[model samples]
Target: MRAAVFDRFGPPDVLHVVHIPDPQPGPGEVRVRVLAAGVQPFDVGVRQGNMPWAKVEFPQTIGQEYAGVVDALGEGVRDLAVGDPVLGSTMLNGNAELLCVAAANVVRKPHNLDFPTAAALVAASQTASGALLELGVGEGDVLLVHAAAGSVGTVATQLARLAGATVIGSASFDNHSRVRRQGALPVPYGEELIAAVRDTGLQPTAALDGAGAEAIAQSVALGISPDRIGTIVDDKAAAEHGVRVVRAGRDPERLARVIALAAEGKVLMPVQAFPLSEVVEAHRAVESRHSHGKVVLIIEP
Candidate 1:
């Protein structure tokens, strides 16, 4: 199997595709023939050696989410079988031709969702859904989503709207139209953010910050209570502001629900894709922090 691996932590160029021995599924596990994998900001941090708690070894593979077909099943795995299309979260080995994961962690992919699209939803779906649940965003509330153009923010905004909350999304002028399309009243970010939300005549009752740059402070300025404000980014600012830092851990059930919504066209995620050979470029796109959508690696086609 060919996998993207890095010998050292540095820049995108450090990632290279190389052949490695195929891995076999253990008991209760299934081996997937990877079709697509999502590249995230967390991967960039891993590549740059920014995450202190993450253990890295030489020639390490890095990726978190993938969509693929089941190629093999290990002992005790019964609910899924060979050739079943599935998507799920993994630790650090998604950017490969094949991967083995626990069957319980995999979600069946809907026929309407393509491989890349299914892969794209893995992380953002879980994160956004968990954040909204934790913040108790619901009817008659206005939800402010920072970095509304981002993957997590995009899903968060749409989900909040579906929950009957008016959404105010913060993004640059370039992404205002896109944010608005996601059911958010688009507002410009930075120092003018609070005023922009006020201009929209929406009072934010809950806030989800995907963008780290003073978003918690801005949410506070908008009169949102600290307990109602949550951040997935900038834990430091979250602590300083006494706001909640939402971990939004991965959950297969939550991911599956969002996937079902995506299949029904209630939620959408744009994918910027690159071939597996161009994994370096994929990493670069994610690191740029300006990609219009989720960045993914096309591993099969």
Candidate 2:
């Protein structure tokens, strides 16, 4: 099996592909022949040695989401078969030719959703849905999403719209049109954001911050209550502003719901894909914060 691994944490260039023994499934686990994988900011942080709490060792494989076909099953698993198309969350091994995850944690991929698209939805769907649920965003509420053009933000914008909320998304002017297509009234991000949002004439009742920096503080300046402002990107700022720091934990059920919506074309995340041989470039794209949507590696094709 060929996997992306980093012997030591540093820049994106540290990531390299190498052949290793194929991983075997344990009891209740299933081995997947990975077709695509999603790269996240979490992966970048882990690679930069910023996440001390994450377990890491020399030559650690790095990726958190995968979509592929099942090839083998382990003991005590009877719910899925060898040909099942699955997508779900994994840790440190998704950027490989194969990975083993608990069968109980896998979400069946819809036939209409291709591998790259399914892989793109894995983390962002869970995070965005969890944040919206925690924030109580719905009808009659005008919601502001920071980094609205980003993976998590894009999902958040679309999901919030589906829940009957009017969404205002913050992004670079270059992405304004893309954000608008996702059902948000797009506004430029950063120092001028508050003014831009104000010009839209919609008062935000809640805010979801996927872009750190001054998002929480700016949300405060916009007259939104601290209780209704949630952030998945900035915890320290959330604490400083006395707002909610959303912990978008992994929940297979939550991911499944979003996947179902995606299958019906109700939600979508654009994929910026690179082949497995360019794992380094994939990391660079996610780290740059300029990728059009979700950054993914096409591991098999």
Candidate 3:
């Protein structure tokens, strides 16, 4: 198996592909031949040594979400068979050509959803859906999403609208059209965000921040109650502003719900793809914080 591994915590240049022993499934797990994998900010953070809490070893494989096909099942695994398409969250091994995960954790991929797109939805879907649930964003709520052109922000914007909330998303001027297509009224980030939101004629009742410090403070300045404001990006800013730090941790059921919505065509995620050989560039893109959508590595195809 070929996997992307970093020998040291540093820049994306430290990451490289290496051939390693194929990972086999343990009891209650299945080995997947990865087709596509989503590259997230989490991967960049861990690679750059920003997340010291995550255990890292030399030559560590680094990726968190994958979409692939099941080729082998562990003992006692039933309900899923060889060749079934699946997509789900994984821990630190999704950048590889093969990975093993608990069979119970895998969500069956819809026939209509392509591998890269399925991989793209894994993390963002779970995060966005969980955040909205925590904030109670639904009918009559005008929700403001910071970094609205981002992977998580894009999903959050669409899901909020489906729940009957009007969404205003903050993005770069070049991405405003993309944000609007996701059903958000797009505004620029930084100093002008407040004025732009005001021009929309919608006072935000709830906010989700995926950008950093300025975003949290701006959400506060917009007059949304502190409790109704959430930040997934900056906990320090979240604490300083007395807003909710939306952990939005992993929940298989939550991910499955979004996957179902995606399958039914009610949810969609745009994907920016790179081949597995370009793993370094993929990391650079995520670190750049300007990729229009989910950054994914096409591992198999």
Name model 1 segments beyond 4 Å from true: none
* TM-score of candidate 3 on Cα atoms, chains taken together: 0.98
Ranking by lDDT: 2, 1, 3
Better of 2 and 3 by lDDT: 2
lDDT per residue for candidate 2 within 89-171, as digits (tens), equals 99988999999999999999999999999999999999999999999999989999999999999999999999999999999
lDDT of 1 by residue, 72-188 (tens): 999999999899999999989999999999999999999989999999999999999999999999999999999999999999999999999999999999999999899989999
lDDT (Cα, tens digit) per residue for candidate 3, span 42-66: 9999999999899999889999999
Residue 93 Cα positional deviation in candidate 3, in Å, after optimal superposition: 0.4
Better of 1 and 3 by lDDT: 1
Q: Which 10 residues in a row give candidate 3 its minimum summed lDDT? A: 292-301
Q: How accurate is candidate 1 locally (lDDT)?
A: 0.94
